[model samples]
Target: MNKSELISVCISDNRVCPMPPQWVKFEELLSEMGNGKPPQSLILGYWFDTSDEEKRKCVQQQIDWAYERGLLDFAIEYLTQLKPNQWHTGYRK
Candidate 1:
């Protein structure tokens, strides 16, 4: 699907944050990288006011999860760029 369609799916499925105003750009970025394909593995979560160690652990978990799902490129290129306050993982099958 196209970027707009992907974004719509993400919203409809509650795969990403429900904050449309904020996440529209993020979904667009994912759609661009996906090149019209949907991700096989998508993880979305949030953390707040955590210790550095905890943040590291969360990040590592995201990486490990994406890698095991064969989404290392997406993990490195997109997931790693996310802010610590939120988590997003996506990988093409």
Candidate 2:
């Protein structure tokens, strides 16, 4: 999908562009880096980062969003449509 289509999908399905909340946070982080909210500056000596937490939250949000959008079964059905040949146990003498 092109940018426009993807934007529409996210907005309609996820309620936000890109749908992943962390991506939105990440964008904010970048926007703040210049203003002094940089991760490295915050952690200093720690490895803990909000990015990981944000990512997990975003994944959860995506799951919830997809479920709410009723796309889970649709996606499964779509994939099912692509199912390859099924095999049954059979042998010829």
Candidate 3:
């Protein structure tokens, strides 16, 4: 995939905050990164610098977001088929 098409990552703010109380913190981080508005397309970025747990948090957040909108069917199949580590990067291994 084209790098420009991917959401720009901020390795310094690599933690993916969980929903509920921490959702505000996550939004603040996004606003600081200049993505205050809802992205036109799916927003995804990954970095090798972050921990494997953080990568899982990021993917979980996306799944939660889609499920909230009743769009889980759109993502469930592809996501479920991947091995746990495969979700940690933007590229296929």
Candidate 1: pairs in clash: none
Error of 2 at 37 (Å): 27
Candidate 2 local accuracy as lDDT? 0.33
lDDT of 3 by residue, 58-77 (tens): 54555455445544554444
> By TM-score, who's the top model here?
3
> Against the hidden reference, what TM-scores do the models get?
0.35, 0.27, 0.39
lDDT per residue as tens, model 2, 1-93: 333343234333223212223334433544343333322211222213434334334433433443444444432332223212211111232
Off by over 4 Å in 3: 1-46, 83-93
1-93: candidate 1 lDDT, tens digit per residue: 333333343333223332222234434544455454332222234333433344334344434444455555664455334454443323222
Candidate 1 vs 3: which has more TM-score: 3
What lDDT does candidate 3 reach at residue 14?
Answer: 38
User: What local lDDT does model 2 show for residue 83?
Assistant: 18
- Cα error, residue 81 of model 2, in Å, equals 15
Superposed on all Cα atoms, the candidates' RMSDs to the truth, in angstroms, are 13.9, 16.3, 13.4
**Candidate 2: residue pairs that collide:** none
By TM-score, the candidates rank as 3, 1, 2
